[model samples]
Target: MPARARLCATVPALLPSSEADLPEVFGLPGRRLLAQRGDSALVVQALDDALVPSGGSVRVPAPWPRRRGTWAVAPDASLAVFAGVHAVRAVEPSGATRWEVRHGCWYGACRELHESYEEYADSKDHRYPEGGSAGFSVDGTFVWAHVRGPLAAGELGPDVVDEWLLLDATDGRVLGRADAGAAAAGSFHLPHPSDPRQMGLSIGEGQDGAPLRWGRWDGRTLAVEYVEGDLTLMSVSPSGERLMTVTHDQDALAVRDTGGSVLEGLEWAAGTAVPRHPDAEPDNDEALPYWDWAGGFVDETTLVGSTVEGDEEWGEGRHWIIDTSGARTPVEVTYPVTVGPQPPTALGDGTWITPAKSGEALYVWALD
Candidate 1:
């Protein structure tokens, strides 16, 4: 029998512009932050235990347009780091510049550290430059960043095009760096849940492939271990022991140890593990379901995932609660209300979230 999910809470989306552009809810160790973006600033607000917005929000002046890159808010919501085209800039809530680290331009052919976003803000070539990302360590004491290389004034050859940096989050000092060895189209940081010293980087090379890199910073040196290409690091388990990942083609999902060895995995096979949608046209060829490139652990031994993208045309999306402790198969999840096409996002607190039909709120669910 399919497991059931109960509605636990509904949190409104933070919209800085239109309703469709809701800000993302960033997951911190035990807290969550809604990082909303605006024309020239970002609003960082804390989420209460129930996932509702709580307390005052911090507005940090953005160094460039929100589309130029991504930003990470400090654990305390006091600082915001912008990983932009030409630099990684740290800004405070009071509109003050804390520090900046200029790096090689993300624009493939541009080599100048132009000093300001306005320099190439209107240039056609800079319109869609590839970008990098940053995130704070679990304790907020360090910032792990992925950037196009040849870091400002650093001793490195042109061949070193991309680098993962460990910086002192408080002062923006470069503590250590490691070559990413990727022609990244983009990337993001996944901070470990318990260990401030460890973090993950997932680099997307568009259709080429995705590369996952795990980094460990021990105060003096930064060591990186490369996982196989084409895997996107999704989330770390609550205990910081296991990781969840999906293949680039979305055909497989896996649970891995910190060392990058797969401990358990599941794949989709037509009319078997994932049968054809009942609502599919009777005469239609059998459709194979692929896992969504999203989802995470609800706890140490269980997870919530979806075949939403693969099921969309056939009917309403399908979600599941998979046992990672041993069974290693997906049991469908029955929701109390209609869930959207977006995959379920596990909160690591025995609950998960799905966008409501209204597009302005999220419905949190727990096992019924």
Candidate 2:
């Protein structure tokens, strides 16, 4: 089994401190503040204005006993927390709290929000025996979740059945639920660029012969749209105007307009390959595709990604700048550290923030 790594807790200097009783601190994009008092994590924001903790501190209740998961920050600066057995709560900027109407089901699942950072829950009737995963809409208003289903009387091989669910982020209401039948493994939620109420679902095999399924959700309804290859990496553009997905054998990044129509398709260079990092374990199935780690869009035209070449550790990881103009090239940026997870996110001003795992430190790299 792959060793588990805990997320670093130390807050970087760029991130406001939780120690002082101060109201707020100015950081990169806005004024940020954090408070941890009486079993709650409070996040406050003041952007392009005077910093004040009095107006925006969101107090999140503590997790239930025996289970724990990570917390996610929404695009609008809200807090989405999964408290094991308790509930998933969305603490809004106005300090309003809304609990998942359906609780006690998503006990130990990977929960995340759309851009709005509202709360959502995956399918609970069918649970993944070992690990759980989920995805959200771009606006944070909707979610699509998958859970492993029960086995047959004399089943063989890994659990072959699974379930898919569409949820309303506003109230934890189950909008639609479906049993994906056998050979179904995982599902991802991709938001539409122009429509906040619509999202796309990508379901596929986990490791072996699991079938890949694709569908669309229009808030009030769910429908299977396409069933194709085994999808590996899936991402939607920041503007919610485009969707990009990659399969195992071939890679094609398709651009879809707001109407769910394919506008253009870019095929990855046939000979290019993702390289394996030295620290990755030999049996790690998740490590196969290097492009899986490469995501984030600087704009509608400029997309940033990481590329790996071979099993042998050779050159430093390459950053590729891709665009609709059809030219792909590596941009030069110095990576401060050579070890650990190297996930990078591009900031607004031609710069990127890569957080270090060991400490409360983040390296700001300016792209020249």
Candidate 3:
């Protein structure tokens, strides 16, 4: 049996503090972070893999005005890009514009592209469109961007059939692209930590089997090898050989190969069958457990799991360490400090990170 480690909370000394209020802290790959205050997003980097923040902060002109848009940073942490209403825009550290790509917008009645951010933000539709899931690749060489297609049928027409594009990180030029042949309600990117040319795009259709598109970019052509159905990919293994996903309804956590074959499946009901707390569901009612929507690999075999379900014993949520190397077994772990109630994101490394609601700092944990 594996025992849980009680990790202590430590704030990155380099993280900038807003005098008025704590700014929003967002974790990026390569142990970097962003502190957002209204229209400005301050990009900060970690001094070392320990995730200790460094000195300089770059101010980025946030897209979407409010918190309506999500941003991604390039490899060297020089360029920052945000998903716009009908396009993706890359900006400099000084909040200057670099380039923008005009993709399709979501207004069904109006197929025209959005000229300004205000017009697109005003629409009450999917603020983040079915095709608005955009982010840069692992190596920061290309950006895998999702754009809405023309309106179709059966599932809202071509709009459901989104476009996945690979754009040059420097000029925002389309290098390779493909049509995601599914009704994507939501989507995300999973970049292979080791392989820069490979990545994964997951599209959620709000059911038991969302489509997972595995893409291979071989310099010239950017193509999807196959579409794996029925799983919401959370993160790829550090080795890039295996990828992890949550069951359609959060009933289980599964690991699969690059071919989309289920290598291991850890059912929540089976793992949480024995309740550690009195507030846990009764033995008979343990048919379902609310698994955190997002989690990441600590190394190649260990995973940090979180859940919003809790009782008087647990504050807002609970964290668990599940060994995915073999024979799935879950051990509950507790944080030394409070970081509010929200799903924690895996930082590709061995860190489990969550944002503080106060927007000032991040809560991070490590397994010993």
lDDT of each: 0.83, 0.43, 0.64
lDDT of 2: 0.43
Q: Order the candidates by lDDT, highest first — what do you get?
A: 1, 3, 2
Considering TM-score, which of the candidate structures 1 and 3 is the better prediction for this target? 1
Q: What is residue 312's positional error in candidate 1, in angstroms?
A: 1.9
TM-score of candidate 2 versus the correct structure, residues matched by position: 0.57
> Candidate 1 at 292: error in angstroms?
1.5
Summarize candidate 1's per-residue lDDT along 118-216 as a digit string, tens digits: 899999999999999999998899999999987876835668889999999989999998899888999988888879999989899999998999999
Model 1's alpha-carbon lDDT is 0.83
Clashing pairs in 2: 115-138, 193-240, 274-308, 275-308, 275-309
lDDT of 3 at 330: 74
Candidate 1: deviation at residue 244, Å? Answer: 0.5
Ranking the candidates on TM-score from highest down gives 1, 3, 2
After superposition on all CA atoms, what RMSD does each candidate show versus the true structure?
2.1, 10.2, 4.5
Tens-digit lDDT track of model 2 for 1-368: 11112222223332333332222122233533333322245443433422223353455443421122323333345545342222344445445666442222322353222222223324443233232234455456665555443211122224334555566666756676555553433344444544555555555444553233444665566665444445443455656656555555433434444343456445454223333454656577654434533355545555555554322254455444555565443232344344224545543234344444442444444434
Name the better of 1 and 2 by TM-score: 1
Candidate 1 lDDT at 350 equals 88
Question: Where does model 1 exceed 4 Å of error?
Answer: 16-20, 28-30, 264-272, 281-286
